[model samples]
Target: MSETHALDQIAAWRAAGRKTALATVVQTWGSSPRPAGSHMAINDRNEFVGSVSGGCIEGAVVEAAREVMTSGVPKTLDFGVTNEMAWEVGLACGGKVRVFVEAVE
Candidate 1:
């Protein structure tokens, strides 16, 4: 979904008193799938919208977002072709991505 739509969904979740997190690609090196502004909105239920690293590391971002939702602490995640999980997620593009995930207040 578009960032605007995803952000709207996050707002709706917050309105319903559901915990949520926002993950954004803060930095990237090489041929990262998504650009730095790419975003994802994740709820406490582990459901999410948007993409931070295409399909490559969105799952990881969701898991981290879930953790952030629970702990109320932000996290920075780094994934690259050198990481085995990158290969698992088909991020064979040999790029590196840095994502920041924080709880939605």
Candidate 2:
């Protein structure tokens, strides 16, 4: 989904008093599925929108987003061929990505 649409959805959740977070692709290298500036909106309900890795690593991102929402602390997640979870998350296409996850106030 478009970034605007994702933000809109997250905004609606926030309006309903639900905790929310946004996960953004801040950096990418080599065969990345999604480029920097891509986003995903996640709420305390585990609902989400958009794509950071075109289906790769989204589960991890959502889980991290949940923690960010709870702790009110941002998290930087790195996944690549060298990371063991990269393979598990289907990021094995030989690319590296840095995602910044932050609570949405």
Candidate 3:
């Protein structure tokens, strides 16, 4: 889906008093599938929309969103294929991305 649509969903969910987390790709380098500002929204139900990487790092991001939703704390996460931890999440292209995740009221 388009980023605008995804953001609108986040706003709508927040307006409806649903627990939601917003994840944005704030930075990217080297053949990333998405550019900076790409977004994903995850609700308390664990549903997700949009994407930050080429399906490589989304699972990790969702896990982070779950934490944010539960803890009400915001986070900035960095993932790089060159890093072993990142590779565990399936990012294997030597690309890097920074994701900002926050709870949405």
Candidate 4:
């Protein structure tokens, strides 16, 4: 989804008082799907907005975001989309991405 829509989701979640987290693509290597500064907003319920590594790693980001939401701690996750982990996540495309997730106050 578009970054605007993701921001809108963040606004909506905040308006509704739902616990939320924001995930951002902080670093990238090789041919990652998204570049730095890309955003994906996550809620307490695991619902999300926008793309991090396109659709390839959003689920993982959502999972990490859930942890951040629960613990009120920020997390930096690194995904080497060229390793076995990538195959597990179905990201055959090669690249590495670092996602930083922080709880939204």
The prediction achieving the highest TM-score against the true structure is: 2
Tens-digit per-residue lDDT, 1-105, candidate 1: 467877998999999989999998899999988999888899988888888876878888888888888888899988987776755654668889889999988
**Lowest lDDT 10-residue stretch of candidate 4:** 83-92
RMSD of 3: 1.6
Cα lDDT of candidate 1 equals 0.85
Full ranking by TM-score: 2, 1, 3, 4
Question: What local lDDT score does residue 21 receive in model 3, on the 0 to 100 scale?
Answer: 94
Name the lDDT value of residue 91 in candidate 1. 67
Quote the RMSD, in angstroms, for model 2.
1.2
TM-score of 3: 0.88
**What is the C-alpha local distance difference test score of each model?**
0.85, 0.90, 0.86, 0.84
Of 1 and 3, the candidate ranking higher by lDDT: 3
Error of 3 at 59 (Å): 0.7
| Candidate 2 local lDDT, 1-105, one digit each (tens) | 457888998889989999999999999999999999998999998999998996879999999998999999999999988887855775868889999999988
lDDT of 4 at 39: 91
Q: Which stretches of candidate 1 lie over 4 Å from their true place?
A: 87-90
Q: How close is each model in CA RMSD to the real structure?
A: 1.7, 1.2, 1.6, 1.9
Q: Which parts of model 4 are misplaced by more than 4 Å?
A: 1-4, 82-84
**Model 3 C-alpha lDDT per residue in residues 1-96, reported as the tens digit of each score:** 568887888888888888899999998888778899998998887788898888888888999999999998999988886666853874677778
